[model samples]
Target: MTTTDSTTTSTGSPATAELRVDRLETVLTPTERPVPAGPWTASLVFAWRAILKIKHVPMQLFDVTMFPIMFTVLFTYLFGGAIAGSPREYIQDLLPGILVMTVAMITPYTGMGLNQDIQKGIFDRFRSMPIWGPAALVGALLGDALRYSLAAMITVALGIAIGFRPGGGAVGVLLAVGLLLVFSFSLSWIWTAVGLRMQTPESVMQVSMMILFPLTFASNVFVDPATMPGWVQAFVDVNPITHLTTAARSLAHGIPDTGAIAAVLVASVVLVAVFAPVTMRLYRSER
Candidate 1:
């Protein structure tokens, strides 16, 4: 004999005896299918989720808060006099360059975070949702804005404390910080692409360090290009980090280097154009 869900037998397993047919139907066949979120709405939701994560694990801001302090303080005191005559003299230049470096360095962590999510099956769940495809990636990037802003603020405030003064004043500093954020946002797209292609978060970090170390150190970040060997100077001149640091230093000091600013902007555009689509493709290909 066949038994329908409506029929119940108290003599059988207790679990089966208490089964409810209506509850099963309600789940298997909902009254209405939920509407999919709009692209902007979905992206924002993921961004908010990122903030909630930070709320629970406050230490997530460790890199954001600590990097600026160490780079600004350590470099300002240790290498300042040797490089630029005194800590004060060096800080005037060091602060701006360090600000750019600090933010740029943290960009790699974006990839690490993405890789972690992928391993934890978080992205799988995200992909299964009926939301915009890029929402999760874009939202994580949007969340990173807070970290970048915090780094900039801490670097600026600490710089001022140590004798670094922005001749351009508050407005100029704000403008410089805004530009750095824009460039950093574009820079992060490169890492997201790396994150998707790499098998593990550690691998992503290794590649990122290899790329970033050369770019930041070989650039005109710490010292004047004129003092470097001709070949190194040649490379530094074309390095995008150099361009960004030069432009940021100019803006913070109130001079505003238009050519450098233009170069940074162009580089930002190129990075996004090249990497953003690749990241999306990789994100989609993942099973």
Candidate 2:
């Protein structure tokens, strides 16, 4: 007599046992699952995630680092004498302009990343998690603070190399940077909302750049408002970015613009108040 050995499963039935055993094989197999993180925990994840993206896409640094240096070099060499009458004076004047513009340009990327996340369905996954309700988004926005600080410091270092110096001592310098980050941080929410609502990241980029470019350029960046056309002068004087840029220049070179500093502070506070809540609302809806 010939005998065959077979394994028994949940059921003694031969065919059923084979089916059950096969199912068991699948259940026992290893599989991958995404880890769940809460809002606060998600914030930490988002922050590190942003850092990792920055590392992988090092080219993104081109705008913050290279843009300032290139523009400074080009403008100083090409238009310094014509515009400011001398390279040295141009460097001094242009440094503030470049720093402000650099910050302005770098900020839109905050929206770009948010838009990408929304498009990729990452936000939906975030919603499913029991983490801090808005913490992940807030953390992502905060992540850009590091980028802004790096850009600001690098731009100032470049300015120093080209003979620009902040007359404001260490305290003033710290204040200036603190103010810049505050302004940038608050402004970040507006773009974050845009990203959440928008479909394409590119659209967010274009719209943000259009809004930001004019704001920075129309400010007292490279030239005095007196030279601007009357209407332009009115606009420039009133631009909130002008106040901050002027304040930053004051902190750097002792320009004595107390009113500008106050205006910047007020505007930054307002921007944060207006946009942060809006962003959270939008995030809640989508979640």
Candidate 3:
């Protein structure tokens, strides 16, 4: 008699065999779930990463550090005698303006860094990861706050070294610095928008300078608006930088001018409201 050994066949439906196949399928395929992180926590992580990057690339901070020193010293001495009768007197005015200018000048780097990441595929990778949508930009801005603060400190220190004293004392100086940082943080959103649209980091820098130079020089930063031509004074009257400088100067001198301060605050709000959404949209579409 011929007997066939029992074996499982396709036609043979055994419950144990089905269970084995199900186990095999489970083993063959794996599902990945993204780790959960709160938006603020994610942003802080990105900020920390950015700060660490500065350790490897110290030159990234060169502009914030050296520019403040050079501009503070140069403008204080070069135009001091003519502008304010002496360097000592001029710095009281010039230092506050320089603080604003330095922070404004460095704000573009936030965009440049963002553009570089986009070009390098880092931003693309970030998009793929599970995190808050605005975490990258928010974190970068947070990191830049440190840079702005550093520039402010350097400018004030250099000014003090050269006989520039704030009539407002420490409290007034701190208030001025705080106001500058708030404005600079908002101004960075504009560059962030520009950077998202630009093809290269260099282009972002170029475009930023184009927008910044007029705003910086045409205002009351270097000289009193009263000294400027009538035509220029008209523009200065509307220039947001002039308002910020005026506010900063008043705070530094222990003279509180609520109108100028309110103007700067309003301008900052408008800038962030206008540019922040544009930046986020561009960032989402980058891939």
Q: Pick the candidate with the highest TM-score.
A: 1
Tens-digit lDDT track of model 2 for 1-287 = 22343334323465553557667888988888667675677788788888887899988877778887887888787888888888778877777777777877777787788788777887788777767777777788777888888887887787778777668766666677777788888777788888777789898888888898899889887777877899998889889888888888787676558888889889988987898888888888843
Q: What's the residue-level lDDT of 50 in candidate 3?
A: 81
Rank order (by lDDT, best first): 1, 3, 2
Residue-level lDDT for 225 in candidate 1: 88
Question: What is the clash count for each candidate, in the order shown?
Answer: 0, 7, 0
Model 3 ranges off by over 4 Å: 1-34
Q: What is the C-alpha RMSD of each candidate to the true structure, in Å?
A: 7.6, 9.5, 12.7
Q: Which 10 consecutive residues of model 1 have the lowest summed lDDT? A: 1-10
Ten contiguous residues with the weakest lDDT in model 3: 1-10
lDDT of 2: 0.79
Across residues 17-135, which tens digit of lDDT does each residue of candidate 3 receive?
A: 55586578888887786676889988898889889988889898887799999999889889999999998888888999999899999999899999999999889888898888989
Better of 2 and 3 by lDDT: 3
Q: Which candidate, 2 or 3, would have the higher TM-score against the true structure?
A: 3
| Greater-lDDT candidate between 1 and 2 | 1
- Please, what's the RMSD in Å of model 1? 7.6
